[model samples]
Target: MTLPEQGPLRLLALSPFGAPFDADEPEEVHVALANGEWHGNHLHPDSADDPVNALAIIADAVQETVTACLRQVWPVCAEHGLGMHPRDANGRLSWWCAGERLRRGPAHIRAAVGALDTLMPPRRPNRRSRRAR
Candidate 1:
């Protein structure tokens, strides 16, 4: 989908799936579906000026579209198996999830906004060989 040229938002939109860019709106950029339906406010011009704020704003807008239109959580936490929200970690924008157990800590940062793919992919262990052993 069409996003501002500035900052990591454009990269974030392309990383998960290559969201197509469109110029139909004329005045505003949109993060749209394959069918060209996008649900959220256009990226504010000022949001593109700052790296961290840009990511946060982009994440918020994306989440809004996914939740309202798609009817589900966008980037969910692997460990906690819950929806993640954009949170300011230090000066960076990160996907934050409430930790699974209270004793382990209240919450934790899963990954930086445009970096969710960096999390370890699901692995299927070699159960057949292990059982044979």
Candidate 2:
């Protein structure tokens, strides 16, 4: 979850459009990047019935859009440097990495879907200490 300290915030949006198959249905929503660039199927309307399912669906769509449109992996594993995928970890959605740990097996959960910031260590001040000077 080490992001650049300076850059435009990469925000996500839900872009709504008429359902392609049926005009009578509710508008379909696609998870899009801040610029409205997205590449993925519209989120299933039924997913909204459950908060967990909705989160999973939205996360998948956002990942697809970021990966395809931006041409870079989102939420990479800090230890392995590999892209993580959303997975069901005991009924909780988590970011799972394929990279193996020394004794932890073939895969690991990097973090829960919306909790990456918790893993980031607090930043140290930039000023040099008196000992260094």
Candidate 3:
């Protein structure tokens, strides 16, 4: 995803070698920025067994890393303009917005993780109407 001031943002897996004393220990996998900067706890290896759990874990890690390293919210709700958090909506992992709507309650799911682009309106080129011309 592209940030207006930061250019494009890319996330990558970073697995460093385990401690020298424990050569057999598995490497801990972390979500890192393109430049190799990351923050927060490393992803739990057990989470990899479940796709839904894995997505939730990764989303949380990404949010933590982005907020700390970039000093900004990673994904903001389009309608409410508020920062959204990763949450479990039913059985799916989704981005949850805390902003309320007219009788819509206090919170709602904006979109599934990695599907925020679907909520964004399509970009249209500027074109003057015939009347204006």
Alpha carbon lDDT of each predicted model = 0.66, 0.73, 0.77
Expressed as tens digits, the lDDT of each residue in 45-109 for candidate 3 is: 89989999999988888888889998989788877878999899999999999885765667889
Give the per-residue lDDT digits (tens) of candidate 2, residues 23-56: 5556667766665666888878799899778878
RMSD of 2: 5.1
Collision count for each candidate, in order: 2, 0, 0
TM-score to native of every candidate shown: 0.66, 0.70, 0.72
Give the TM-score (vs. native) of candidate 3: 0.72
Model 1 lDDT, full chain set: 0.66
lDDT of 3 at 54: 91
Off by over 4 Å in 2: 1-25, 101-105, 122-133
Q: Which 10 consecutive residues of model 3 have the lowest summed lDDT?
A: 13-22
